[model samples]
Target: MRAGWWSLVATLLTLPLAARGASAQTSGYLDVDGAWVAPWEGAPNHGRALSIAPAIRRDWQRYSLSSEGAATLADPSHYYVQNLVTATRRSREWRRINFESGLLAGGLAYRGEGFRTIGAEKVPIARELFQLQARGRADVALDKWGFSLTATGGENFGGAVRQPWGVEAGMTRELGRVLLYATARADRFREYDTVLVHDVATLDSYALSATGGRAEEYRTVQPLLTMTGGGTVAMGRAELTTEFGVQQGRRMIDPARPRARKAWTELIASLAATYRIAPRILLRIGGGLYPTDYVRQLPQGKFVSVGLRLERGRRQQVDWYLPPDLPAFRIDTLPGGARAVRLRAPRALKVDISADFTDWTPVPMRRLKGGDWEAVLPIAPGTYRVSVRVDGSEWSAPPGLVGVLDEFNGEVGLVVIR
Candidate 1:
């Protein structure tokens, strides 16, 4: 099962890299960390954990594909989990509002002491789980203030955890050199199998949810509500942020003891700092003192974590990149009122074209003997934006055309045909 999960990830990883030529761009990052969890639930509870997560993404003018995987190893019971996920996102921009949506599918495999079974038999209750998720986000930025909203829903296949849904809204404002923001989120999990959770521990529940567990029938209905306000100070190559907030939530309650049904509330405070050690490297350190009930089914505790991230390709070129030597495309009117579009990649192994006229579908362009790529389309009298893909990379506006930011927060070349 583990091999199959990894094989699926390998396939997803290969799809973006399959395109040949320097124009097919892919970027990603790798993160690894080791941390210790101090026990607050009970005695003999100190444990250490090590985790590695890597993600890669490829894009074409208007569409993008991404895959991520993580492996975690923990001490105390020698527990470990393997997870992989792949997703596609489509985004478009219209005037002041930008919209984006995506679908994600993934699975998780868990193994550890006492995980194989119950008592003398192997139960396999939480051995394997699968999940699917859908999410959407929208953002609007004005001169000084920006607002955004995000929503997500997902389901868990195994009976251990429930389906879950969440929504978040936020607003930010530029205040001189510091940025101030306020945000709120409400996340709720469906009722889950108390029996299985009890056997595996709430830690499993939390970790499983991270792997895509959804809400369902009940042993517990964990719902979280949080409101926070914070300010970020960015200076030179470093940024620091601090936030104070309060959270209210419900935890796993004993149905047999229905009398214990009061809601729990706690104050939340967190501080974080990030430094750019180099153009492609980042160092992050952060900590928070929020009660565990906000997320996991554990006791209230404070924790700190440090991390490093290294990136390349599009991931590292968010700010700038060298433009191609020639215009990405040239439009000429044909004899029968058709438009002849010629792409200017002198050395691309593959090239595809996408535009609103084609409903944003990708169509392969024919390669000419001179190495130029060409496609003919019956374009109507209208304004549209066209993007091209070199190899299987993210979409980008063809060179020489005017550029505009799309709803997905990407800049694509703009075209107006009359």
Candidate 2:
């Protein structure tokens, strides 16, 4: 099966030059690559396999589309295709609204002999089997903060056919080099036992329902931090990056089991370095490890993966789009002698304002004429460091300071909300 899949891919790549001429006018690029996985401690022992994939992308002034198809060679053939489309409109400043959707399809094939023996009796064998799956996602975004929902369903007809479906919602935010995200998901599956049991009149069928099995549903929240720095050093071209991530979740299992509920957590840390080998290529090396723990079960094992990526592109650009109408800041004195400061920015920006020693959360600031922004917060009548951010980008104050830390290039200002 693997050989057959590779043959087909070779044929496609060897097509006449004239056959490829039709894509000359397309704006997107094409990527083709393959990977080989070695047997691991707990993974299946498939010697090796090859895969081929082709992708295309096109972007217009306000719309973009991308599609790709992949075929993998193994004992059982695996194939899939993914397509996505998005439309976006930029309002004023850097505020923009976007709508996106995508689809995915795939299947598995199994071809093997099945034989059985029962108390000095031998039984003959029969046919093959496989599984199919389909999934989709839709989302809307306002600048850095966006909302996404997804659904997936799959069925296995070969062995004790069963079906499963699930849905999920997620939110993402960026703060300078730090990213915060959280997701809640619920899914249900039909359970079937393939092994035969003696004197068992009937087999039990378990159906996970959306409302009944809250324990079966799982939710995860993850927050990550990444730092990047690079410049010429004494020995040679030098670059460094560090990242840290943590995740926690709760999971459900068979109700018949005494301990059917479980919780899990994971942590990851990584560091990388790069040295210039040439103008077009660089020598890169990196390593990272992830550790996870689960309740009632033997703690899950950890693994580390290290690889390099060669990149070729023009110099990067920092583009900041600020709407023509910026939010206004208002100050008011309360009867109790407390001061109030308010700022109103675009709803999409998810603007958050805070001073030293105060936690920032979402607040409704009234909209004013001319796209003006306003916010009110009582301060102790002293100078304080004020900070504002939309999505992950910090608003730049006068003097071109990006943010609180110059190293982070975030936005910060010294304002007395009093």
Candidate 3:
């Protein structure tokens, strides 16, 4: 099943240059995290869990493809792994609203021990299952006020996987360097029809209602509300980020497993901070406290993580532009047979230029008093291709130049060096 998917990803990564006459970029990262979940609500299996995740992503002109895999190690001697791949298409903003949609496919596997009904007695049985899943999401953003909405749904095939559907809406406000944001989400899951219910009271009630019914399928719903606000401040060689959030939700536990209640109310307050120790490495510490469901044994909802991120090329900047300050490009010829390149971006940190003439290495342009940028390069009269990086953002062809695909599978603007 995965062989075909990997092949599809390869084809998609290459087709942007072949079909669209443009270029693209491929990037990825690897991360490892460890945490200890103290015993909560007298749960049997509670201990340290280590997780490793790796991902690869490719970006084209208006679409992108990404693949990620994750594995978890638990103290109870169980194995769980998952792989997900997604493709997305982005649409240009109409007025102040932007839209995007994504399609995803994935697989999950779990190995554990469980009780199986045999004759009249339950016996321990090895539980190993694999599941395939496909999902889709649609997101909408109102650029004027930083409001967004998203909806997603997915189905699982094989084993005891649950079909999930969810929706989220959020908003963000930026005042100076401080950012405030909040989100509200609701998710619903439908379990497989073959799973047996282990909740004695719920099972008895179901049997009484159906006159001879055996529990087959179960449904769980969760509605959560969360709000967080934080900002990143540059402190000398490192950057410091702090955030606090409050979450309240109702989680319907798996009916196939015996639990305290059919649905439990969850309320937690969380605080997290991160310090960038270096350009590519960071240190993170976070913890949560249960206000309503706090138990003496699970005092620490704590975690610490160290992350290292590497990239091959320049980083993309936030695509934020006020209505009147969009970036544009222009070119002019000088008396000394030099080509003068100009870019108009009233609100930009820096603008850099790169072309085949420059060996594809970026060189900064001088910012003019008029809030634009200009760079004069000596070149013979000929046609050349050039790409610009605005404020260390993604490589893009400036407006007014002919768009052509680059060797990296992305688009660049064609310029006349004459």
Candidate 4:
């Protein structure tokens, strides 16, 4: 499904300008990505292929728009198009409410031969002769630890028909460096099967199908638990997460047979870990296993899989400017002395400076003296590259404070307070 792709696009598009170094006055970004996959159990031994996708994003405060498409080349080729738009609002403490929708379409072909459809069956030669799908989601977050809910729906418009709708709710809690989350969801799917045939003389072909009608509604309830923790592990900077879940469902078969009604229970477990091998490189590994059994039948399903990924990127710095000096002050503590720095501003200036010291990975900022802000970073006491952005403007510091040139729109100074 394109749910993962759409969700990623929406996250990047709606990220706060303050976090992305964009001014509240304007927002946008360009993203490029590629991937390759090897054969799995159900897939045949076809040479690896490559795929590339590009995305564009634009945001207006709480509203955002984004779109992306990908093309792939292989013995059997495929391509996909997708787009999404979202609007979100965040509370003072950063709780979020979001609404999003998008569309996905694609075609696939195999070894010069084209099959009826992609994702329907395995053929020496297959193609997405026809397919289009639409999906949407709505979700809300409560503080960092609380309850959240999401509703999702989708439809497939193609040679073979498929439509699904579902809703899920989850709760989360944070305990020190570890977090726990649980979720439950229920959904139903309506699917159609198509077939084509050829005969001699006057050859003719048509589609045949079966369906789970309204009376054939299939329902399932899944409850999942995930635990995540991050710290400096033996493999350097690393994080480990584990998830376990259970699903129970009832399946009704058409043409009612002796075993027309089947009830099954499934259990799933997964683990993921990422290690930063170097300043700019990271390695990730993940694996999952599933076991299932029918209540009144024999064991029917079991699956195990693993994957790895390596990534490298360079970090860059940018600048932002702040509004006029709004009643802010700075306090500097030298190895043996301390001094207070003050700036003059109008009486209407309502902003204040803050400082804080914590071991949090994403350190928090604290308000300090007038016009002054400070943070005690959990890093070794050495000169480290630092960048600062003010009031949602581009970053402004070091060599050039190249933002708005108002009296209050620049860096105060970089202090080394032992």
Candidate 5:
């Protein structure tokens, strides 16, 4: 329903900011995407759209909450909105195994003025659906594997009433800077009157609104089966992600009729790239082919998309220190009222430092020769807690700097900036 969708999305977008004062770890992001789409087979349904997705995650003592929302508006008045909020209760680890259970609430809606035309082609578009599910998850650190099960029920996926029941299991492993994952899933689906799958490449939010029919529903005994594999590689300022999947499912051969069943198979592949423009700014681009949407009763299509995202994870973070005209193991006053801090450990491979000012997030130092590190930074002419780790080892204070106990009962080095 367009009723409270925008208000809900506004709440989700501002939730992280509202939780900043809490003792929880809170982060959020906002994405703005511009999309263009064309029907995979038909003459043409080419159109332009704008989409926005706001997401937030909060982690507290023994629980966590994740909320995501989206809204899209297309040319000639096509609109869609979606929301998913999940709250999980974390369990105490038992012998290398961790467990979690949560409830999920997801909903979406879309509508356009009955018929929109491009050239001489007119297409109908109206979609909306809602669902709720309970999920249980288990993760084992021994092999870096995670399994999850969900019992779900929803309304208006394809028919008058949504077919319930869906389950998915996945595992992930990290190798160096690359992460690999695989998943298998099965879900029941059905459709009723209108085919709401609409256009895939139009706006991602459109797909999220998959709902069918006003009268009867299409249903079969078999569930949709899918298998997927994906990987992500992180490079300095850039990252690449890829996914490949195969889906086998049954649905109404013709979306209009509440008829028997038809089996279909499809291949899914996509690539996405992201570049960090700044601590809180990012640029992203992605596209690929899609499979049939049973909920909206729409056929499969291809897509390409580009977007910009603003992340809260690294907000207000400090930059890596830079080399300056300062001596190692000493401090010097630099131009522009800045102070230079230097290290002279020539045998160390790499050096990093953190201070109270940097929120204790380590900032790398410019290395010369073997391990001589130096960086220029600005700080008030006062004393502050500092710590250094060489080659990313345990934090410790070097000679000539005061050593004291920190809030965590750990040792920290003291640096005086003049």
Candidate 6:
């Protein structure tokens, strides 16, 4: 089973790289990292390994297709492989609001100590896990504040998480270089057999105990709340970002001992610095300690990694950058794979934006509390000509962007999305 899964994942992963040069609208990237991972839920041995991830993406007017894969090897006998494909479609933007839906299909295979067992002899075995999910989302974004809600349903085969469903809603506020967000999520599902996660371990602890044991199937309703604050600083050719957040949730894992319901709280903190070493190359280093992922059954893993990300394309990246607090046209990736094109218009009474991808229709920007204007578009990876007007000004490009000429003999800014 493991061999078959590896073969399938390899084939699926290679398709994207093979189609790299097939179209200008398609691009791919590769990330290689080396890290030291600590224990979780009372793991005995620590792990040090290298992980490689590669993905390719193709974009159209309102639809996007992407395939991504990752391989991690702690030892010759211990390894994991994951590959997935997703296709998303966006409805036409109307009045600063857009709806998107997508379907995802993927599978993963792994082998480790006590991963699986069979028969009374309790022989260790390997298993393959498959997933299929359908999700829909609605986003309403303005100049300064944005809100999003998503509903998802999925089934997992060959895993404890069987048929599952959930809803997540989030709100974001823009504060210059800092972005603050809060999310509330509720999930109702049944786990055939779940790992007991009550006894947690410190990420820096070396001496750990074994408390992991199997439990019977139980129906659970878990509601989680998370709050995050992040800030970014630009330093020459390098950008540093710091994020801190907290998660609080209650898990009803044991129905027999209902009163023993364990409530958990965890901290989420991470710092990453990316330096543009070359036009198509970036050097990144980051580290963080995170708790278990209840949905995926991933243990509490902590690591520090240094990696290089390579962007495969012929276009030379523009070297100019605008300050986060300045009035600039920019694209910001929100949670849940949604992207918003934002413009800072501090004193404008009104703002309008047009792009070739939008069929050249001027969409009015939604104003935020502190003079930020934004609009969501279903644009894919490629070069686009964009023009914006603020407060009834002339049609011109946003500040600090590479200027170009449109076919109408008008000035516009060339924006490259990768």
lDDT head-to-head 1 vs 6, winner: 6
Whose TM-score is higher: candidate 4's or candidate 5's?
A: 5
In model 1, where do residues sit more than 4 Å from their true spots?
1-25, 76-88, 109-128, 194-222, 257-260, 266-268, 290-301, 316-401, 404-418
**lDDT string, candidate 4, 29-77, tens digits:** 3323223333323344323444434344444344444444333454434
Best by lDDT: 6
Candidate 3: residue 74 Cα off by (Å):
4.3
The global C-alpha lDDT for each of the candidates, from Candidate 1 onward, is 0.64, 0.39, 0.54, 0.38, 0.64, 0.66
- Candidate 6: the clashing residue pairs are 143-368, 143-372, 144-368
> What tens-digit string does per-residue lDDT give for candidate 1 at 1-418?
4632673466445644533334345677667666554433333544667766767776655566777766666764444444445455546678888887888776666554332211123333235666678989899989678999999888867635557788999999876547889999999886543222323333233222223344233455667898989998865457799999888876444433323445778877889887777655778888776654322222454557688876545432111111234344687789999998887554355678888887889988898764468899989888888888765546777876887767765666778887
Model 2: ten consecutive residues of lowest lDDT: 292-301
Tell me the lDDT of candidate 1: 0.64
Output the better candidate (1/2) by TM-score: 1
Clash count for candidate 5 is: 5
TM-score of each: 0.60, 0.37, 0.59, 0.45, 0.66, 0.64
Clashes (candidate 4): 21
What lDDT, from 0 to 1, does candidate 6 have? Answer: 0.66
* Inter-residue clash pairs, candidate 5: 158-190, 158-191, 158-192, 193-213, 194-213
Worst 10 residues of 5 by lDDT: 314-323
What overall lDDT, based on C-alpha atoms, would model 5 receive against the true structure? Answer: 0.64
Question: How far is each candidate from the true structure, as Cα RMSD in Å?
Answer: 12.7, 17.8, 8.6, 12.9, 10.8, 12.6
Give me the runs in candidate 3 sitting further than 4 Å from their true place. Answer: 1-22, 42-49, 74-79, 110-144, 158-161, 192-263, 268-302, 312-314, 317-418
lDDT of each residue in 1-418, candidate 2, tens digit only: 3422343343334333212322121222232333333222335433343444444433323343333334444345322222222222222323342334333322222232222222222322222223345655666666656576767666645432356566777766544333345565555554332222221333232332223322232222222222222221122134555555554544433223323445555555555555545432345555454432111011222333333333222111121222333324445687887665545332222344555626445444444553334565555766555555443323333222222442344445665543
Predict model 2's lDDT versus the native. 0.39
Q: Identify the runs in model 4 with alpha carbons over 4 angstroms from their true place.
A: 1-21, 24-60, 66-144, 159-161, 194-236, 247-261, 264-267, 277-281, 289-335, 339-418
Misplaced by over 4 Å in model 2 are 1-97, 107-144, 154-162, 198-302, 308-418
